[model samples]
Target: MSHSVVVGIDGSAQSRAAAEWAATEACRSGRRLRLVHVGAAENGTRAQPESAEDCLPPSVLSVRDRIAAALPGLELSCVRMGGSPPYALAAAGEREGLLVLGSRGLGGFTGMLVGSVGLHVAAHALCPVVLVRADPDGGAGAAGDVVVGVDGDRLGDEVLAFAFEQAACRGATLRAVESRALPTGPYVTRAPLDQCEIRDSLAEAELVRLQDALACWHDKFPEVRVETEITAHPAGRALVEASRAASLVVVGRRTPALRAAVHRLGTVAHAVLHHAHSPVAVVPHD
Candidate 1:
């Protein structure tokens, strides 16, 4: 991956908010910041623009100037391209350390919490993708825990690694949560006593799994405070609720199988991205 943080620029308030967040992250990580804008027109269909600078929207220029003024020490660059927005952005993500975008862009419906472009990039990007929304109250970056959903599988190691790094960098608590749903359907026992016993057993097992998943990360980030939670709620709901007090909510996207025709974000990650109260990071894992 390139030693820089890349953000999609479109002139929307949400995109501006994402750019600001990306600037802060680039500063914290000591990486260059790249502002990329993809034109709505198809690559070959449109006439050649007078110049790359002329093609950039005024809002993109404004964002660049603001970041330059606010972060005088930061190395920044801008690029204008033409093609499908999601494809262009995903290609940039393949070579960048991180890619960030607004939850919704200028073309998005006002009611959409996350636009299609954001969802598509999160699903297909080779690197981690962060979706930031404009927080009018400016409370998203306030002191809070970094929460990650733990599935107790090998695929979750990448997610855990990212979460631990984020927590260590911010000197924040790391909350690892494992959520389990109770048994249902005809196979489930109907007796309350039996159900209660089964739930207790399941909870105990889940707690152990969660602890085991966090063991290695704890060793790696000894300075970061760690917390583990096992809940009976659905994973998506549990994560969405956890976002209320978290500065960042992290979820994993399973790598698509070789023969898979379509790529998509997992249900839990999809829900969190749509409803989480804070910025959300979707880390892809195999």
Candidate 2:
């Protein structure tokens, strides 16, 4: 209930990944770690199978032991929050906390919530929501850069604050990927022009803008190594490419008051959530 790293556990591979990621974040934030499960079975009256590894809501009672064995030295607790998983986690994060979940395969649905529960929580949660997808090789957290999608939009500062803090904690480089749309007017002539050269020039100018925005933070967190990628490609596509080697991908959604609708994610954030291979953090800001 207090400040804690809240992870949804279902005994799946992704769930374990989320739990591990949450544990590491908890260690970094100096907060407690709680493994939570929500199920439809009411009052333990439903017929249930007896498997120690079962990740059902009732397993919330036994998962603490197994998970504690895996992540020793960290303070861990387990509980079954009532009601739907997405709504329960959202309510838990309504105050000061972070909600972590495993990314399930949500097929072919754009702007739909990630894996139903994920998109719902990401879209509606009061605090930041992180979606963890373990490495294909079954590796743990990324030992590489912490990549964040930046558009110089309203939430740029808030996104950077979270990304920078995570980078500093992980001792990883911070890569800020910024994509800008180039106006296709007379400037883009039909002549045999140097397309690469024109793109480079535009990208360089955008790079300067990104640098200027991050200037103060660079000074504030001198320890965080910063890198920038400026491209004319779509924001979503560029970020998904960047996520290939990233440990975490940080993106922003408009705050509740500023957001016109709760369900729709800005183009880039929506795209990256579905495509990124690394853990994605949906941060809301004004």
Candidate 3:
């Protein structure tokens, strides 16, 4: 991956917030920052703008200048690309270290926390994509733990690596949550004590699995404090609750086997992106 952060610029307040967040991340990770704007083509088809000026609107330029002033010494560049916004941003993400976008853009409805474009790009981006919202009270940088959903599978290794790196970078605690469904039909017919025993036994096993999944990551980032939670609640609900006090929530998406097939964000990632109180990172894994 290129050591750079790419952010979509649409001149909206949300995109501006994303740009600022991307700049801070770039500074923290020692990566360059790129601002990209996508222009619509005539006849509603995907096409490139005629010139760079068409892509970099006055609002986009204004945001870039502000970021430059606030973050002196940081390398920055601007580009204008033409195509569908989601596909264009996803293409940029494939070539960058990380992709950041506003949770919602100019075309998003007021009530929607994550717009269609944000969801589409997050689902398809080859690299990790972060959705950030504007915070007027400076709450985005608050001291909070980095929360990640753990599945104890190969797909989760990539998610764990990203989460550990983010936690180490921020000097924050890493909270790994693994949610499992409890025993059903047979357990329901059992006595109350038996049901309780089953629940406790399941929790213990899941805790062990969660630890095993995180073993190497802990060794790699010993400086970061690690916390693990095994919940019987649904994965999405558990992560959403954790997100209330988290600075960032990291989740994984399984890439489809067919390159031409459309991909999905999965239920857990979709829930967190829509309801998480802080920024959400969706990492794509095979």
Which candidate number has the best TM-score?
Answer: 3
lDDT of 1 at 32: 93
lDDT of 3 by residue, 158-225 (tens): 78889999999999999998887756635554455676787677678878877876888899999999
Candidate 1 residues 1-286, lDDT tens each? 2599999989888888888888888888888999888884233346232125555767788889998999999999877766788988888877886899999887787678899999999998889999998887632354589999988655377788899998988889999888766565233655665766776776778778778767877999999999999887899999999999988999999887684557789899999999998899999887
- In candidate 3, the residue pairs with backbone N, CA or C atoms under 3 Å apart (3 or more residues apart, or in different chains) clash, namely none
- Backbone clashes for every candidate come to 0, 2, 0
lDDT of 1: 0.83
Question: Candidate 2, overall lDDT?
Answer: 0.75
The local distance difference test score of each candidate is: 0.83, 0.75, 0.85
The 10-residue segment of model 2 with minimum total lDDT is 46-55
Tens-place lDDT per residue, model 2, 131-243, is 98756664456667999888775535777888898899899999988777766644565667687777666667878888988889889899999998777788899889988
List where candidate 2 sits over 4 angstroms from the true fold.
40-63, 105-113, 136-140, 153-155, 183-202, 258-263
lDDT at position 271, candidate 2 = 85
| Candidate 1 worst ten-residue window by lDDT | 41-50
- Name the runs in model 1 displaced over 4 angstroms: 40-54, 137-142, 182-205
**97, model 2: CA deviation in Å?**
1.9
Ranking, TM-score, top scorer first: 3, 1, 2
* Regions of model 3 farther than 4 Å from truth: 40-55, 136-142, 153-155, 184-198
Query: Which RMSD values do the candidates have, in order?
Result: 4.1, 5.2, 3.6
